[model samples]
Target: MKPIDPRLLRYARATRLFLTAVVALGAVGAGLLVAQAMLIAEVVVGAFQHSMAAAELRTPLLLLVAVACGRALVGWLTELAAH
Candidate 1:
């Protein structure tokens, strides 16, 4: 195998770390997205199928909002890292 240059190694390592962070953040965002989707589905299904009251869904609705915000924040952080 060819020997790697010291400067090249530093740059490669930095790139790898940045990519790793971005991927981790992206995975977090994906998980948050899934949570948000599930929450929305539950709310919709509950309302339509079970005729659930808004008061009864307050917790899940709040959680849904929180997850949506979390997903947005993660997306913003990922964009910042990419730049």
Candidate 2:
């Protein structure tokens, strides 16, 4: 019936901090996912539709890699925080 259980707040103070970390990591992970999708779309459209050269697609491709790595890191961090 309660949004947040009062017992948790009273008995598990560390949980508040842990929950905050999890929420922040979740947001970061979601943003990274969106960035990854957008970058992939950009690269695909540039290469296939626009017939762009490799040089033109380089930046987006590199950014896509970075975003992928970031997502991995976020996942690792979430796991660490959960445990």
Candidate 3:
């Protein structure tokens, strides 16, 4: 096996950080979805209301998309920085 370099280690750490952020954000987004669903269901059952309390799900989704885009950007940056 080849030996690992310190620079590569730093890059690896950066990649891991971004990946962790992605995972955390995904968890938050999923929680939001569940919470919203429950709230909407309760409202519908209790008050028979049919309106979105929060109509800005696009922001977090966009952030998710940005994080996905960051996957490539950070990976490329890490590779370039490592070398």
Residues 1-83, candidate 2: write the lDDT tens digits. Answer: 85998878786887777778889999999999999999999999999999999999999999999999999999999988877
Clashing pairs in 2: none
The lDDT-based order of candidates, best leading, equals 2, 1, 3
Candidate 2 Cα errors over 4 Å, as ranges: 1-11
For candidate 3, give the lDDT of residue 53: 46
Q: Score every model by TM-score.
A: 0.85, 0.85, 0.45
Model 3 TM-score (2 dp): 0.45
- Candidate 3 lDDT over 1-83, as tens digits, reads 98989999998887886666666655655665565566445545444344434334444445545655555565555455444
How many residue pairs clash in each candidate at the backbone level? 0, 0, 0
Query: 8-81 in candidate 1: lDDT tens per residue?
Result: 98888888977888999999998998899899999999888999999989988999989988988999999988
Q: RMSD in angstroms, candidate 2? A: 3.6
- Report how far off residue 71 is in candidate 1 (Å): 0.3
> Of the candidates shown, which would achieve the greatest lDDT relative to the real structure?
2
